[model samples]
Target: MAGQSKLSELFIKCKSENRAALIGYLPAGFPNQSDSIKIIKAMIEGGVDAVEIGFPYSDPVMDGPVIQEAAEVARNNGITMAKTLEIVKEISGTGVPTLLMTYWNPIEKYGPAKFAHDFSDSGMEGVITPDLPIEEAGVWLATAKENSIHSIFVVAPSTGDGRLKDVTSNCSGFIYAASSMGVTGTQTNVANTASILVERVRNVSGTPVAVGLGVSNRAQASEVAKFADGVIVGSAFVKAVLQNPSDPATAVRKVAEELALGVRER
Candidate 1:
């Protein structure tokens, strides 16, 4: 575990446990600064093998209403890049592999090299830039590689087989397979499209695949666990914290535990 990249260590740990990995996402500053950090720790304690801390952007074109609203709260509360790094550093200290999930535009404005160094310095394992296409990621990849940070790319259901290989080639950790075609949010049922996309990615790269975008409750997590190497719970966790802001940590903890149990069913 110490020898492998943190992301690799997570996959290896999950495999050894005979279960898929559980990844939970939360904006760096959702309800408030104090509650956000507490919520993340609660997530790890509940059973997340890894965490994705969202760097809230004003225009989150790829996010659903739940996540977009969370972004608004974070930004409105004065959550800046500095505050996000502070939160990342604290969460990384929990010994769970932590990755910053953000839009590529923020990295461009912050300078990829500078951002990579800050992330590494903050004890982050890596990053997941959902919007950074492989065609335009050469410099960012180089910067991340230089800092020993893993790069994860999204492999959509619509992606061609050739493009799937291209995207996987740029990925150093695992591939994030959006379960549905639309933006990120919870759905009543896990998308059947994810299994197909995962199979396609497997044909090209052996990297672990995590299904994201629609997973909500434990049953859905169990559904995705059948196919993916990991189950990513984002919008649901964000929604939990958003709904119970006064007790966000407990809300997040309960959801994380459910997702963790679901993954263990495999």
Candidate 2:
């Protein structure tokens, strides 16, 4: 028998532990390169089980103000695929599974096969391509599969049952379920549709489901954790980095600790 993929193993571990996984996101080179790496380390040390580091796309259509601003700062700092891979390599050294969240264009520019190979060789476990449609994901999927890297696709409230099935069926990692039909950011409250979507996903697939978008606080994380196998906290953590750029590690640590506690509240 074969062993499990890194992502599947993480979800399985969390499932056995009776709590959702805390997945944290941070844009590489944000606030500055040194601070960005430190921030991610802080979260992992604080309790994050896995990480998604944004590669800073020029057009972040899927992200909200917080992530967009942080990405912009990273871009202005002259971040590139090379730099992002470097960050991923360093972060993965912590033994926490790390993923790169990038738009398809960057992957296209980098050459899908080359990007996947380089990423996997750098010690990262997966890639989350937001804009890559399932219909057009063959090349990316094939390349990732060949490298033993997980490919995660996003499912939204508007995702039809057939599409949901298609997306989830192709998923090697947990399916990324957007809580609401909007860009990512901090929300005043969790989207009611979040639970419904996760339920729908569970009904059709055994792959773990992770809920993201607009999860801002511990309470919201706990609420989503009730239904999701992994609670993804992005914009809120980016906001923490923005608030204390001079020394963001402590602030990011606090946020991750709170979210980790929330995920285990069950």
Can you give the lDDT of residue 6 in candidate 2?
63
TM-score, candidate 2, is 0.97
lDDT of 1 by residue, 148-195 (tens): 888888888889988899998888778899887889994645658888
lDDT of 2 by residue, 55-161 (tens): 89889999988899999999998888898888999999988989889999989988998888888999888888899988999998888888988889999999999
Instruction: Flag regions of model 2 displaced more than 4 Å.
Output: 1-3, 186-188
Listing every candidate in turn, what is its Cα RMSD in Å to the true structure after a full C-alpha superposition?
1.5, 1.4
lDDT of the structure predicted as candidate 1? 0.88
Q: What are the lDDT figures for the candidates, one per model?
A: 0.88, 0.88
For every model shown, what is its TM-score relative to the native structure?
A: 0.97, 0.97
The CA lDDT at 190 in model 1 is 62
Which window of ten consecutive residues has the lowest lDDT sum in model 1? 1-10
Determine which window of 10 residues in candidate 2 has minimal summed lDDT. Answer: 1-10
